[model samples]
Target chain A: MSALRIALFLILFSFALANENPDAHVFPRPLVIEYPENIEPRFDDEVRLKCASWRFAGEANNLNPWKTIPEECAGYVKDYMTGKGYESDLLRASEEAGVYAQNVELGGDGKDVWVFDVDETLISNLPYYYEHGFGLEVFDSVEFDKWVEKGVAPAIKSSLKLYQDIKRLGFKAFLLTGRSDRHREVTVENLKNAGFQDWDKLVLRLPEDHVKSATTYKSEKRSQMVEEGFRIVGNSGDQWSDLLGSSMSQRSFKLPNPMYFIP
Target chain B: MSALRIALFLILFSFALANENPDAHVFPRPLVIEYPENIEPRFDDEVRLKCASWRFAGEANNLNPWKTIPEECAGYVKDYMTGKGYESDLLRASEEAGVYAQNVELGGDGKDVWVFDVDETLISNLPYYYEHGFGLEVFDSVEFDKWVEKGVAPAIKSSLKLYQDIKRLGFKAFLLTGRSDRHREVTVENLKNAGFQDWDKLVLRLPEDHVKSATTYKSEKRSQMVEEGFRIVGNSGDQWSDLLGSSMSQRSFKLPNPMYFIP
Candidate 1:
């Protein structure tokens, strides 16, 4: 075939593949409702018909300027962390595991500090994924840095507020994410932009090691916190590895992550 | 030996066994966390802290009373479902799975419907587990029914609100849960007590079939919905199996289940 004809053929093939699924990375399959009717009705209950998916074009597709994440979810995040008697679990676990700091109070020499994963654990990153249509690809620090620079992805507002509340309450905060250290400048900028003003430390996942098992890398970081003489009062992450096997942070605080996971 | 001495010996023996680890139901050892920080990160990401050992306890734990759950996790249940857009990956998955009902303009027959699971999907059940101190030995549906009946457990309030919104927009609602069919009367009462005035249907799992995958039984129930010409918009469940391979429901809506999972 002529060179021009071959080029035309390739273009046609690409278009066909794209057209096969119109929404691109966004899957628009209809939801199924299949709960059965009660043969023996009993209690009065509130049922919700919820949509499970949102339109996410990945980091590539999000064209909307970054803004605060939805308020409804923000309230939910804040309430989840601060509400229940979860501290007791930490206390009990700490006592059992001998991970508790000697001084019960926070900020006592910052000897023991709690480290958190920033993206899913501390803030919401789904907008970046959905808006940009970026999925399954290695995170581009350059693009990520740019995204944070734009201040498009908001900290899970509630989590940020809770972190602030925790800081005010005396717990020291350290952030550790799977994000490469190369993006440290932008990540720090984003956190400050999102309202996390007083973190005791911020630990980005060193590309060579921290990104391996997010849980293990995070757990190892706790040792650093411990070495600093701070007993990790608590460790929080959207993933379990962030808190697994930490001798100091007996209690682990987990936030909800519906978007990306390292499991 | 004297009877008194014998009784003392027995008591000591029992204490030793009981104290070995009260949570006999828990699987052996802990899940992997912070593995060398440099291993390939599991890209799936939503792995729970208790990912590896999900068992009988994990599946049924949600049925416990809300107050029994840890306090810090109170709002997690509610937050999981109501969170939408790019902030939540699970919700994003639900959307991508094509579970959310859309284009109301396309609706014609009132018969088209969807079925959903309760617990983590619609009702926030984390408080029950967290407050109860991860009582692995306790699996009390009656207590849960009472709690639900009492209406103290908060609805994934956002999801509840969304459900109301969906119903108002004109889609019939149905519920399918692993809750025993025997408790149907109490379940209905609980729904009403929880402020679900218009729950159209409820289906509970058979006690015998609840052992393996509850999704199998749920999928069986989808036949009934299909017979009614209902295009199941989406399925909502905390476990993967609940939404597995049902023709009636084109998509599955999965909510975050931090406390436990059946897989």
Candidate 2:
């Protein structure tokens, strides 16, 4: 009994030491809670009003480079990324999309296509945003390009699941992104690494295909898909431009992306 | 010509004074910029992992009272509330609903019904939320009730437009809420004050009708509505419970709400 007790103690002590090991990097530093008294308010009424006005008007007028996402909007963005509300919404949408796909009778002519947007839809740029102050700073294309080249974006779990489920239901998955064709190789590597596999096609913007807006560019590509005898049954994107315009899919699902406005 | 210039200068001086007047409240205090150096890294890899886990598991397992909204989630909520993304989505949905309503041949029997949820859908509690910490603080029913009794919640602009448009299109509007029947009088008064007119019926939960879940209770009421010879053509709410279950309306629109989850 004494020998058994000693062995049990040794096992427990080793487990405790393993948990406390800093080399494992398992334990993160506690979140520092700054009291309201300690910190000045990041947003004022005027800034809040401006943010609201910008949100309402941005749809009609394209956003200019001079405008930056207000610091006050950071809280709203954080809630979408880490809160239950956003997860619940995405789950509901993906589940509905799955059901819609299941109910549709596919002709199985190998021309049934489902379109998906890349950023903030299938994969997240959240890590980059988090490190860079959540759009409080001006958008730098060079910095963003470097981040994309790293090819380390995490998959939006629900979307990735939906992709697989739709594919299993006999729909061809096509990745349609506004990313320039120059980064096609890196984008492909990122998508695959992020658990997206066996996509039918990956469409990106070509240098010669300079268009007025993302809506026109994407709509023309979708029209081309339709002209090729492909029936786009379902399309999912984070932007209105991806879902709107001619040759639209029968059903369009929009995932939330509030970080930036795309025309 | 010298006298005219003097007059112009005086007018410009007066205009500037008017703008600077505190009573006008036109200008707000500037937002204070807190450098990243001031903020300790609140979200590390472990924290990120934990946030992701909580998101996935919280739906099945109710979150603890101690768990506060993470800072990153603020962005998501803000996007839903004050970002162009949400406004654009709602406008698109309202337009689509209008087109659908217009195309359908109504019997002019007044049996066609359009359902709208009271809170977050029709009237917004944004003022109350803004005064508070936007759900960073725990919800206190007493405080919320007092705020509600003030009868000052502004109408959600897009929803108000939709309500008027659908009502003009000959669909009978019904306001359904999870608020108890005891507050019906106050709720009615609040709605009236908020510019909602001529809702055919307002449904609220009765004391005896308390069920295990909000979904079951709301679903049962909807079933009762269907039995009363009303064809629910459109139903809209912020919560999934409002749209789900038996006797669902032909179309359902969801407004964004990231503040709280109603079971």
Q: Output the number of the DockQ-best candidate.
A: 1
lDDT of 1 at B129: 52
How does candidate 2 score on lDDT?
0.65
Encode model 1's per-residue lDDT on A166-262: one tens digit a residue: 6665677778777778778867766665557878788776767744676567667777767767766666665444654444354555443323335
Poorly placed runs, candidate 1 (over 4 Å): A1-263, B1-105, B134-152
Per prediction, the TM-score for chain B is 0.57, 0.72
**DockQ, all candidates in order:** 0.04, 0.03
Per-residue lDDT value at B198 in model 1: 80
lDDT of 1 by residue, B1-263 (tens): 45754453344223322333322311111111122424443322223222211211122221211223233332333233223311243334344333245543536678756576776666544445544334332457676665444333334433454466557767777897877777677666645544566867887877776775665677777877777677777566766556654453644455545445443
Residue A256 lDDT in model 2?
Answer: 49
- How far off is residue B25 in model 1, in Å? 33
Q: lDDT per model, in order?
A: 0.47, 0.65
Quality class of the docking in candidate 2, CAPRI style: incorrect
Point out where model 2 deviates above 4 Å.
Answer: A1-67, B1-263
Evaluated on CA atoms against the true complex, candidate 2 attains a DockQ of 0.03
